[model samples]
Target chain A: MMRLRLVTALLASAAAFVAVSAHADNLVTKDRVGPADAPKSFTLRLTNDGPTSTDPVWAEGYQKLFSEFIQRHPGWRIDLERMSDNIGQEQARMLEQAKSGNGPDCAAVDSFVLALFKGANVLKPLDEYFTKEEVADLFPFIREGITGPDGKIYAWWWNTDLRVLYRNKEIVPDAPKDWAELKAAALASKEKGGEGVLFNGGRWEGTTFDWLANFWAQGGKLVDDKGKPIFAEGENREKFLKAVNYFKDLVDSGAAPKRVATIVNYDEFNAAAAAGTAALFIGGNWQYGQLKNTLEPEEFAKWTFSEIPGPTADQRSTGTGGWTFGAFSNDPAKVAMCAAVVKEIYAGPGNALQQQLPTAAALYGKYDVFKTEANETFAKALVNGQARPGVPIYPEISNQIQIMMGDVLSGTKTPEAALDAANTAVQAAFARL
Target chain B: MPTTTAAAMGAAQRRVAGPSLARRIEANPFTWLVPVAVMLGVFYLYPILDVFRLGLTNASLVGSDERYTIVTLQAMFENPALLDILKTTAVFTIASVVGQQAFGLAIALLVMRGERRKLKGMVALRTLVLVAWVIPGIANGLIWQMLFSEAPFGAINSVLRMMHVSPVAWLSDPNIAMLSAVISNVWRGTAFSMIVFYAALKAIDPTLYEAASVDGAGHLQKLRFITLPQLRAAILVNSILVTIQTLNTFDAIISLTGGGPGRATEVLSLFTFNTVFRNYDLAGGSVLSVLMLVISLVLALFYASFMPRREVSE
Candidate 1:
């Protein structure tokens, strides 16, 4: 009787353990998208904006597209990780993780830093996944930017953004076409008891990239054909100096407050707008989505964007930037699946929902949302948009430029002195590399 | 009876086993420290040694081309901004240490006076001061950033605007930005020094103050002659510790000014961080890390000099 009782207890324990294991499996598999009986199961670890993102609109759009993609691909699941809101930190973290071989299978990388990853040789090239016809559909700059030095596509440059002067239609009815008009309008807004124009004057890439448009409008190049930084060299130096001086004039004349030097992120610009303190600001085209999400409908409607004012009325340019996804999976099947995921998010309906201008020019024709007046303005702006060079040295150059801006704008150093110092630093870094 | 039983059992065990291995091992006090030594070696020594090792190599966090070399160290020292960064670090450390010590000592004296006089709400005051210290450094930075926001809507600027005064660039101007960072750091760190000084004050005999009062020594005189001299060791020790702490301040400054308005607040810690993470130069960052470790170690020796000496026997 004792033996029979012991045997029964052991049998009961084994049955309970099996039941718990089956329940655990059910818990893991529950709420999965697509067909449950699909033969293949693929899980993608992706780092991008997701449900936990601080920006609700961006998060919602990303989450929706990811779910839709998983539903389309049977037995697929995505483990989404929220990327860092700070661009520099995110890029650095991605590069560090890539070296460790423990990073996510796919990561949302800034387009300009794709070269750094390519140099690391951790990203799987996507040339075979994307066809020639598909590649040709991308913007010309993006087509060039996404391809590594070895003439292989390692990332999908899905969407791009343009920097522009966002103004309140009620306060500033007419767009400023030049630096002089911009300053005049900003001062006029200040006189009317509203804060003047604001831009990213803080120590970050935005300070360099947004202002680079002014230099580019004058046909200035940051680097030469050999990817050598020449922004502070002879002719380019003159243009760079002129551009920085204009920024100084704005701060010195109080058209834009000296405090504009504290603005680092677009969310700050949006916050100023939400407070109804800012009459005009320089921000990205996608800020329209952020503004819409942050402001009441009528308030958001009162705002619109225009080309970033150049040195003169006829000269026009704006800095273009965008996010890209670099696949790190070695398996070709996973790489192809990651490309499909990128397509579902960027090259298709996701672009329309996200409201970022898609890199594929045909998307405008496919999605009516791209034809809106605001997006059309952005599209026109893109004609003169210039993306930062996809070189490893560009980050260092951008850092030096950020410091130079802070110095010149804050009156700590003159534009000439700041540029010379910045040039020296960049040159030394370049030489070391 | 229980104690007697344990003692007898111990004696019997020792006699029977003739100081068995376990018994002999426990007999030496150093055996008790073996675990702690192992922990220190694994956690502290190994990582620090690795930092020095990496400092001698050309390693990158982003690339896999590490090699043993001195070029990274040379590059770090040769970099033009190194001098500026070091100078900024010195200014930041001095300002923060001075501010924390002064404010901490003042608050501690006030609280001690309150307690001696049987004043109400002394506990509340202590807790309130401690709240700042309890807040995480990053949160403190963010809180201060909101308060010092350059925008008109910012808490400080809003108050200034209400008085019809022109707004101040609290975080944009280079000098003012550094001052702002120092102020924020002092606010977050003062509580620590206050607690230390308060405890040291407790150890002072009350009769000293009573005798000083009878002799007609003023409050300032009592503080100078009695309190300060009594706290001399503590002040020195606290100074060294706070200096090291201030040197390692990265998160708060990073969140506050980002070492900016043009590298004005880029202390050694921020420089090391930016080099490793932002510049992707692990070896270069390691060199900076080693420099900081040397500084801390020097300060640690100074701290040790103030500690009470104890005798050891073989």
Candidate 2:
């Protein structure tokens, strides 16, 4: 009893000390972003993806961006939160909170899944901040991608990401011109004691993107000009079936490891690439910094990025995916401030400062990511990067596709059977909605 | 008239002396129950009721058309994957629980024997066995996942390659993935059964084993006659608890497999999680959750039936 009393008293005193210190600290700092004389004050919540201070160079770039924002808004205080996980899950969580009127003032949302939140009325329209012409100035496909069915822009697209083929130059010096050549190259590489390729064939959005490039390359469409499911019709079905079949063959034939179906994304691939284990890797461009840190200089230099190789030489296709700022607050004043901060962070000045691609057309050339030789290819390849199907139910469709691809790659199901299953599942999802 | 006079006198005395907390609680016995009742109503009752309510509706997270509907149930009934999913769950639970318990019993017996014989390294063996249990579930999953991962860096594959043996697809194959998950789970969970069985072993009367030995009973005969009967209650309790635990196990599968290689390792818990969190189908998730709760309840009832008629006077 005496020991308990002493511990309890200590805890109470510690709590009191912490409370007093916090209060004193808050009073002294006041989280200043502007001059004391500035009368107006707004807490603009800014969410962005960038490196931390430990990543000195990238972190310095982010600091420069934030400093620029502070200079632009003399009276506003910005609280920036860097989302540290898969931003898709973050977007879902943010939307879930918004439904209950419990959300941050602003957040970065994955552009592909933005429609899900927008359809649920979790995102506020940004018409008050961005003009119609300004929205139009965004790459037409991207603008259409972020626009809701109500024809309102709910998010400001930041720079987008493209899935591309990364290869070891020494192992397979020339980039394969087409799928047949790529397979041949991979097989030859395999003969020399190397894993031929690494790709995310797991059940995830990553798998969906992996399949999407192939589907689009083959001139297949999930939905037609009328926005109806058209794969059940004439040529699309055959093309889609072929794409899925080829995907299976890529794994089963040992061009890609059979274990590819279990790799979620980029986990083991990073280490494997740094160690020079795999000859080919298909992945997002975000890992450039990680590779630089982990890989030996020679190994890093041996790597190059190109458009995802296709079934035919002329078919250059890939999927563009990335994050954007969306306002989550319903308070008109807070929403207004969110829009201003978000716009500044992703467009004009902020775009020019950060390493990621800027969504704005005029600011595309000003990106730091474009300075690298590989990024130059990435930038040019962006033109071929198609946004995923812009629909509220796209996540469901993406899940079905992942399942279909996974079934073909990992299970006993034939490609045709898996495609039929996916079609039925997607149709069921739409019907339920 | 006397009652009125007595009541008046009591009221006058109460005005002079305020009721203490204990006195007030004694006067109104229900007051003592209020906090517990409120907690149950709020935390326990409300959520269960809400789940039932949600299960009756097509309650999706993304839409506002949440109405009284059985679409979720209809879909569940029509799903061709239901049987396969159920089979996966059953296989995972039975395989994990049975394997875990049997292994646990062996370890317990070994440890007890070690204690009697003063065996060297026995303590270290126990610590090694418990390492998986001591680590957090997610961390345990990661350790096993790396061990099972294919190719050059994976622990198992690395060893196999060293021996000039072909590396097996541990997690990628639909046939192998569930077994891999179960293996990881057994590694993490056996410690619980070990501790339980150890205590029961300790509680067994030493005289019984000594007398059996004196009567020239062999080791196996002693185990069958003396140890098995004495361990019946512990075995029943441990078996049921571990089975229920296995049925509810999701973390290892989630971290190691995420219920894939095309949903091959997808247990009921994982399926429910994918529906609720990934698909955002709240009603469907609720139905799955309710089904799980019903199974747990049945197990609980079964355990209750086997409970001792009187207090287990251990």
Candidate 3:
């Protein structure tokens, strides 16, 4: 009787195993798309690439939009995965996965990486799905951010960003319009017992961006028209050296904290600004939104934005920044669908206008201007805004720039020595390109 | 002569028949090995083989080329940032291991020497030490990070201000970041070494100590000779374990430093992670991983070969 019971149990287990195997085999893969008229079910994954806690309002806004998307697209499911504020790392991971031929059908990628992936043929060109008229309707800077060297669009801009000088109104009634005035303000703030100005002087990619914008304002070009790096051996070299020297002197004179060597991310510096410890900070516009959420309305009112001070009185410029959504599938139909989705999400009439209006309102609220006024100023500034050179060797160039800046900041190398070293490295990097 | 040869062969057969080799091992040895063997196969050998396979493929996010080459290794050597990372890793590992062992052994000796009146509290204190070890590594890093925050709101900075002292940039300064990581790790890991030493102390025969005491030996003298000699085995094992743990530690450093302030706290493992995950240079990451694996294997082999063997009495 015991043997018979054991046999019965074994047979039952085997039958259950077979049933499970069949069920698993029948499970639909995420990449499988059904016909339009057929019973369709799908899951879409989204990554926010920012901290969820600091921006609860923005997270909730995206969540609501996702729910609305699910309702609009019947028989489809979506799962949004929020990553911490490390968009560069996320883009690198997505790019790696795409090279392996198995990646997310769509991913939120930074504008810097969009060009790299497009050059590598890992991104699907979106020109076929969106017409030129529709593309032209986007903010020109946003459109330019996603355009490739071949003049094909590989991604859609989700949001746009630009660098602005954030100042404490109590410390300085008027924002400085040039570098010399800014330096004076910093010194004055320090003498008055506040951290004068805080730039991310740490060795990271952003530091290079901070340096290059100033260098460009001083008329320093990294590469000449012949595509050769020229910062070391010409009249332009002196201007680069002078700008860097001034920056170093400011740090050395206690206009900024000695701990500038340690600050890795803008958030840390921004925290100091919010606490009213720092007098001025150069940061992105999203930071204003972050400050709004973190500080009381009264504390928020202490801050305002202006253009970064230029080399001379006349050459002020903001550095343009944005993020892009790249499609990662080789399947034509899937690629087409992804492109359609990006357009629907970013550039559709209501969505595009919605994105613009909120950002403009947020900027105006913080800068103490009307939304219309802020929008017009922003539109005019876009013409003068400079994007980082879209070179494949940008990472290598960035590293060199950071190292050279580190030497100057540490007072180990003069500006001429540092810029010369950086120029050599830049030349090498471009040679690789 | 033939009869003599047959007798000799019978004697040899009798020796073999007394017990088969397998039966002798089974009769005299432990049974815990069956589960251990299964676990080692599943967790260690299987994953090692997977890593070996991954190392061979040129699989990257940017290309479909699966052909293996020395390109990754070349990249590893070519990257200039690796020198600073190696220095940081060495400093962190050495400091953490030495600190944990010294503090752990000292505490173990104190508990062992204390009078019975103090024994309960000492045991309770040891239990408290275990709490830091029991907490997840990332959580420990986060707790320490909060303690080390440079802002006036931070615990360390607040205390400094109350004492009329200037606050230090504990995480931001390159000179202090690795040391701070070591302190956090030592706090979490010392408990393990302490427990091992405690067990070793308990295992030492009470008669040996009593005999030494009868000879009019002082407490320090007894510890120097009897306790130290008896605890050598435990010390060796604990050292090996701590070394391996310290060398491979990732979560603590990553959560604390993120290898920032210009790669000031980056270790080999973090460098490997950045290479593979951040830079998509899988080949270079694999080479670094392989180098780390080889170093670990050599250390393990040296420990196994040099460890003093136990003897049996007749």
Candidate 4:
């Protein structure tokens, strides 16, 4: 009789647990994120936007948004798949998955690689599913960026970020406008027991992406409209060489340490900033949120940023990178569901909390977050921002430039030799393609 | 019924039963090997054959266009970067193997001495060394990365600062990054060689040492003559195993230096990875893989030729 009673109690408890779980609209945990075991499910790939221990605000905001999304959709489920934070690896993995027909229903693809997917015919057009007003609200560049050759929006370019020089006002009061002033200020900081300037100098996309602003600031064109390698040819060669030499000079002058070669991730720069080790760093606008989260309020107030310093005061440019939600499913129902999820997370309050610049022109100034002085500065930076070449050969070109940066920074190769070698490699790869 | 003769009865019984299943299997050894043969063919031979077939094509991960071509192989051979990768692989493998073996033999001899002397911490020392080997390669790489960092809090750099020495760019220098990778690999792999050597040491006859002592031989003399000669087989085996292991090492180096400071530490395996995953050149990566396999096979054959045909005891 006692055994029977215990069994009944266990069954009642399990039933209660199931009832509570079923009542909750969605699941958002470190391991799983979605409405579990629903009749209709769509998988979404995201990175660092889910439950992360490093940033509680991002995690809570994402959870609430996903929960609300599930509540509104009733029976439909949104499965959030965590992807690699490294954009290059994520792009490669996504391309491979799409080719194999094993990809998630929707993914937050790096904006630059969307063209590659579109070329491969794995993406679905978002024109029919999205409301006309929502489509009209997108920023001009984002609209152009996501539009395929056939004149259809293939992805929702949600949020964008720009590279800039983040400086501690306490260390250096004035922002440097050019490379020479920046170097002097960096060296001065080092003399005052600070760790000097930091940037992405490692062998990865970050290294090339972070430094491409300098190249672009000089009006260097990477390729022509036909996607031919031309950055090494004509007047562009001198501009490219100057940009490469600027980084080499930084290390050669002892303004930046050689250890930058190991800093492949922007988080490394943020950590250095939060630790009060770096006086200045070249990083993305999103790092401001990270710094605000990681540092004390008083210390966070000391941080400010300016446009990326150029070869001269007159020449200024920044590289803009963003994430886009792309649909890979052929089923219209699944595509619509995925589009709804993207709209909620991107244009909704979730993006505001995430701290990246929203792509919709209508969404800006709606929140005080966009009105902040730092964000205002980022907004200006975005005005002069240049997106990477969306052609297929851009990845190969970026890779060669990445290796070139390492070689030049470490003094393994001269600026001339590195440029020649990278040009040769890019040209060879382009020829093969 | 007619009375049957014994021979007739036996013949009838044999005809009725035929050969037993076990007897049939025992009669043909090849039947027993079919499962293993199939497994080898399916798992090993098929993949290797597929790689070779892919190596002869111009396949890519992204593009749909693929065709038969030797252009990838020709380009790989003509590229100067291939020579650098080979050189780096040679240096990293040699350094790691030599370091692991040297440290391993020394630790093994010391541990044996401790045991013979009834030392209290012999077991603890062995456990500590074995702990390194048991740790995951990625963890080992991360731990070493922190230790070798040039940051103010870096363990090694902190000690250097305390000693009034400047911090060294352990992972940033083009030359030192490879050394750092080798050091981390040796630390991770030394314990493997130590265990192998320890077992070999246990199998060595104590009577020979006793005889050597009676002959007025010192420790050095005994080590030079008896111990060294007895360890010949173990050394060769360890060399072959460690060589193959170090040749294919990727995880630790990747975590430590990411084969950087301008590809200073990129070995054949890493180069192949970069070719396949980073460059998305499946055919080129396959060709590189085939080259690596050939290199490994050649080295294995070269080592096997020097191995003794029979064990000392046999």
Best by lDDT: 4
Residue ranges of candidate 4 with Cα displaced over 4 Å = A1-22, A25-37, A51-56, A84-87, A131-133, B1-15, B311-314
Superior by DockQ: candidate 2 or candidate 3: 2
- Report the number of the highest-DockQ candidate: 1
TM-score of chain B of each: 0.91, 0.85, 0.81, 0.92
Q: lDDT of each prediction vs. the true structure? A: 0.84, 0.77, 0.68, 0.85
Report model 1's TM-score to 2 decimal places: 0.89
- Give per-residue CA lDDT, model 1, range B1-314, as digits (tens): 99999999999988987877787887987988999999999999999999999999988866687789888899889889999998999899989999999999999999999998999999999999999999988888889889999887899988999999988788998999999999999999999999999999999999999999999999899999999988987898899889999999988988888778889888999999888777777888999999998988887797778776556862
Model 2 stretches with alpha carbons more than 4 Å out: A1-64, A67-89, A131-134, A224-233, A348-354, B1-30, B118-128, B303-314
Residue range A107-144, candidate 1, lDDT tens digits: 77888787788888889988887889989988889998
DockQ of 4: 0.50
TM-score of each: 0.89, 0.87, 0.78, 0.91
| Clash count list over all predictions | 0, 1, 2, 0
- B7-33 per-residue lDDT for model 2 (tens digits): 999989987898877888999989999
Ranking by DockQ: 1, 4, 2, 3
DockQ of each: 0.53, 0.40, 0.20, 0.50
Please give, for residues B128-175, the per-residue lDDT of candidate 4 as tens digits. Answer: 999999988778988998899776667899999999998888988889
Q: Which lDDT tens digits does candidate 3 get at residues A284-312?
A: 66577677777789887888877888887
Regions more than 4 Å wrong, model 1: A1-48, A55-64, A296-298, B1-16, B20-22, B28-32, B303-314
